[model samples]
Target: MYNNASVNKVFLMGYVAREPRIHNSKNGKPQLSFSLTTTESIKTQGGDIQHSEVHAIKINADAACLKDVNLKKGDMLYVQGRLQTHAFVDEQLIKRYKTEIVAIGVELFDPIQL
Candidate 1:
């Protein structure tokens, strides 16, 4: 039995940390992956400090999103999607996991200057 009682959603507004890489999945579907960086300034006991966090984003647009917009490094964007985690084993027999936002929609803010 399943009930629609929960949701998995994420929203991020940050700058692109690197150029988007487009690839094809095993099923031959197009996929896009990129890194995004978000920064924030927090007031601490000592003073205000700035902190930056980087996130790995995976867009399943399958080339449709890139048809019109040109995305590049350092460009500001707003990403909306759901959070997904992938787990794997390392060479040393250690378990590792990574969480990424599976972008369903992306909006470009500041376009990169040529």
Candidate 2:
């Protein structure tokens, strides 16, 4: 029996780390790939320090979507999507895993000063 009680959603708001890459899917649809850097501040005896993490994002849509939104590097971006993990075997027959967000919606906002 299945209860269907599992959720794997993710929401990320951060600065684009680099230019997004566009690729063609097997069916010829466009796929956009990019990474965003999110920061967290930790309070310590030496005062607050910032730590950042980069997340890989993938958007499956038309290339025109990029132009319509004018998405580019250094822009503040908000993404709504789900987390996915990919598994593969390396040349050495070792198994590797990667995790990424498959974006369902994306939006741009003015840069927020940290």
TM-score of each: 0.86, 0.83
**How would you encode candidate 1's per-residue C-alpha lDDT over 1-112 as one tens digit per residue?**
5576889998899999999988886687778899999999999999999999999998865546556888889889998889999899999999999999888889888545
Looking at model 2, residue 49 earns an lDDT score of 100
> Tens-digit lDDT track for model 2 on 1-114?
669778889999999999988888668888989999999999999999999999999888663345578778999988889998999999999999989998888888886553
> What is the TM-score of candidate 2?
0.83
The candidate 2 region of ten consecutive residues with least summed lDDT is 61-70
- Count clashing residue pairs per candidate: 0, 0
Query: Which residue runs of candidate 2 sit more than 4 Å off their true CA positions?
Result: 1-3, 63-67, 112-114
- Estimate the Cα RMSD of every predicted model relative to the unseen true structure: 3.4, 2.9
